[model samples]
Target chain A: MNAANSGSDMPAWLVIERVVRSHWSLSARGERDAGAVLLALWADDRRDLGEGFLLRAAYLGASRLRVIELALDEAAPAFPSLVEIYPGAVRMECAVRDVLGVQADSADSRAWLRHAGWPVDYLPLRHDADRSARFAAQAEDYAFVRVEGDGVHEIAVGPVHAGTIEPGHFRFSVVGEKVLRLEQRLGYVHKGIEQRFSQMDLQQGQRLAARVSGDTAVAYSWAYCMALEQLCGTRVPARAQQLRAVLLERERIANHLGDLGALGNDAGFGFGLTQFSLLKERLLRANAEVYGARYPMDGIVPGGVATNLSSQQIERLREQGMVLEAAVVELRAIYDEHAGVQDRFVTTGRMSPELAQRLGVVGLAARASGSPRDLRSDLALAPYAGLGVQAAGSAQGDVAARVAVRFDEVIESLRLCDLLLQDLAGGAIHAELGAAAAQQLGIGLVEGWRGPVMIALEATVDGRIRRCHPHDPSWQNWPALEHAIIGNIVPDFPLINKSFNLSYSGQDL
Target chain B: MLDILKRIARTGIVSEPQLKLADLLSERDTLHAEIAGILGRALAIRQVDAGSCNGCELEINALNNPIYNIEGAGIRFVASPRHADLLLVTGPVAKNMEIALKRTYDATPEPKYVVAVGDCGCTGGIFGESYASCGRVSNVIPVDAEVSGCPPAPTAILRGILSALASPRR
Candidate 1:
């Protein structure tokens, strides 16, 4: 389709454009808006500018992305919350409120990311945020919205969960086994990662990014480095990009294997857990042997990847890939054929396509609900573009659909891994980055195992990071669980949750 | 069911033997007996993630895989701290999770052990002493043993648990 047809297809963007234009016309417009246009970002030496906070919102279309920026006056920082357009923005709006002290012009003004860790006035991301201040113990209990009525009881599930999982509290209002409402109290894992980013040099910041969510380490680090490289105008070698793809694809497979097993275990099938976990273990061992780190948290660096492979190493990986693909295919057939497992998974945690689009759920969860917009295919970047990565999709938006998408993606990723190994470009694995050019705003978006991991970097003229916002697609997904769990029994929550598998730290940051 | 049985038959048992000294650190068999003897049953561990990147938790979970078969070694991760003999904690204690972690610790019966898992748990790793962080796991609760790696591998984590159980409290 041409630009005109695509433009007409976008209702949300058209509405946002109209809203921005009206706001521009209502107020005394600045020189920035020639004809009520979307404000161009990183303009006019933003590095040296006064304390004006930037509000950035990215709308990813079928083949295009529109990033809208509104420069709010720092003194009275408030913007119209996108919660109306994207209900997922409510928690994020609260995060901005707690972290940067930015007010969202919305009714729901609950605190997020700040569990009374700091005083209200002491926003950690403010220009004058002090590093030495200490706060006393939090005195108040979070007032979760109570579900009122007779026979309606509440079950509080955790900040520290039952298993070896990340911490997040879930409040389930249920009458017997049927869930009435599910209110999630996340940000229990907030470690001041965004605040920590501001203190690092551009080169040192990627380490923190990698830790944003441990499972998606490769994606976060790559995105962070991608942004930094963009700012510094560094050229990553073709070999490095290919190695990065290998690591990225491996990370995806590892996570999928783990989750698939967990989903089975949650559904009461121990055999599924045993087989998938074994496969996952084998993959992790290969990672440790090849990359020198089981998780490879530091594998992807600023200009390129951390490690290079020899031709023999490439051949070894190729042989391993074939074995994994065959085993995964075998397992997929078993999952599809198992009547007991299929009965439990088929209709559990069903989120309608309408609800998914309305709530702005992205990534694999979005794909399960029929959108199927994978960044690898959507953005069509180097290795992914050439490898012809197929976007795995389904319309059921149930646990079964999510499982199918994962299985399909793993098969596709295995195929890509083989192709990537066959076509290795020989060169330096990393490039030394030069001084970052002043007044550049670097943005990097990579398709992580969970979803799209995005990093927005702003560095000082001297190369220290000024402000960085690392966003996880979990922010777009976690809320969907609340809706999906409404009709399901309390026992199925774990299966539904693992199917979505949204990262707690990704959003908690 | 038949396919599952066949797969299990093919996969056999990848879990380490009872006396795989080289697999774990020194004194693997003795530590296992000590743990099983101490509890007189399975050693129930309750894992508490204070504010980790969840990388450490990944390794902790890896201990459950058939290759590690942490359960076969007479240890199982229980849901409730009240039912636990040990607390496996990960991450630098986020200020928000401080009270929750503390509550979890208090809920566990006395003579309970807490093994700090991961570099973040031991020394706060990269996120040391931040405005929102309390640094190490010790900052929130008493830790008996420490596992220090970006995220200590499953074997290292298993070794840390053995050390924590075999040795006395700090």
Candidate 2:
């Protein structure tokens, strides 16, 4: 097996190597409460990457970073669960158990990512299990932890929401109108993306990554392609890199616009929704005309990008950015001055910096709560390194803080967009990439609008994908939601949830 | 409030002019794309994400924007399936979401129509059929019409709904 070190974070890499020091040099064995476990997932080594069965786990940490993993064989098919250290790792550890049959020693030992839709032994990711096998709908009865009190009662919200949103069940324990606990039951949108990735070649997998979560298509696809290019040692052109930046920034702005409006609407401001929706529509129309897709799902491909902007098109984009900046500034003022909105937003759904740090929250939500860990700014690469990126954040850690971060980012993105247009890289838009070598593994990480979207891809001897694990930031942040809603009232849960906007589909897979 | 009103007035109904279904006919879209205003009565739609990538949801949400201004037309998204006349479902039906989708479909009253939005809803697009996916919206519930795009644009999606509404009630 190629223990190709994922040197995305160099400091963490050294720590990981030291912690998991052994012959194979990867073991989280007997380390029960060893720091925060960012992601705990296992790959079936019977397919490739090794000769026999294998298991692994690693640290995707920013606070007191430490890495640990154990290479499991047929005999030792379990690893010590780090759910206690990384409180966020509970769901991931459960997911690992359900899909791969790799057990973990955690107190909250429960099934995740699967309801009774499949057989109890039906681990689709296991080597012995048939990949295309189907299962009948069995009885589903997930035992949600109940709160025992005189007046405390449960309020089940969804697997289906009121609006045109994704599906996930929220079980809220309430007394009167104030909430005591909020437990989220996701995996309602689990599309078997990880298993599906093995069936596709690298090019086809790029398309699958785009669909992992539709909102952050540019970021996901770029991360997938980056991993592929890294494996093949293909150098992307300067112009293509710049264009990818343009697409990524635009994607970031569009999502922030959507969330910004939703935040206001949640607090009962119709004007905010109307004005922001109008602006978003204008931006989307421009995207369709320029990138040929409103969401630009196919914008970023392996070697470079699929499309390029003309000088006139670039100029038009700059103009749109300027207009958006002016509109956002005006909207921010209205949101700030408005009494009803501020009353709802200010102290409601607050998570302190310490709680955020302990839970290991990453991405925009983390930044808002005062963890300045942005991949673009922290690990400045080609485009982001050259065109300066100022990470927008606040220490308040409320709906208002998240709003402030979004507003700051939108303006910064506009500036970056204008800068990119002014200094458009003059070269070929795409570079022809060669085939991947035998038994190669590579890691690709991008700071998506939500947080770091990482794609760990490994190719077989003949160059087909053996295993591809797409890690979403939602896995870490979703647990933070459970904590964020602690003392907040039932009415403010929606606003708090919107502030985080964690992805069900991204994490479910 | 004056600032809000002035800004609203300045923006002033940027909603697109609705064309008759005949004028909107392309060789490909001629079948499903229909006139939006034909259903003069307001439409109450309950959108279900059977298991979409949420690309379809993004565009579906776009229908609310001023330019498309879906409410300006007779169509509006409702809170409950019981209140809905049409079910706008998206994504290839994931196996886990199948039972919930079925329950939701059952909750909506009779004479309701279903329009599966996006390529996934239509034909299970990219992540076709898997252990986790039921492949298409029709796999769980009956579908009246389908709009196929990675995510069909807001206009195409609106037309698909209107077209489904044009059909005889179930």
Per-residue lDDT for B20-55 in model 2, tens only? 334543421433233333333567899999999888
Reference-based lDDT, each prediction: 0.81, 0.81
Error of 2 at A383 (Å): 1.3
Error of 1 at A344 (Å): 0.5
TM-score of chain B of each: 0.91, 0.85
Question: What are the chain A TM-scores of the candidates, in order?
Answer: 0.91, 0.93
In model 2, state the lDDT of residue A366: 87
DockQ for all models, in order?
0.80, 0.75
lDDT of 1 by residue, A1-509 (tens): 01211222122222122124235223213211221211111111121377367665555665544455566675777777655545666787787778777777883777877878878888887757788777764744788999999999999999888888999999999999999999999888888887788788888898999999999999999989887887777888988998999999999999999999999898899888888998998888888888888899999999898888888888888998999999999899999998889999999999988888777778899889987888899777767778777899999999999999999989988998999999988889899998775544566778898777778777888889887888888888888999999989999999999999989988887
TM-scores of all predicted structures: 0.93, 0.93
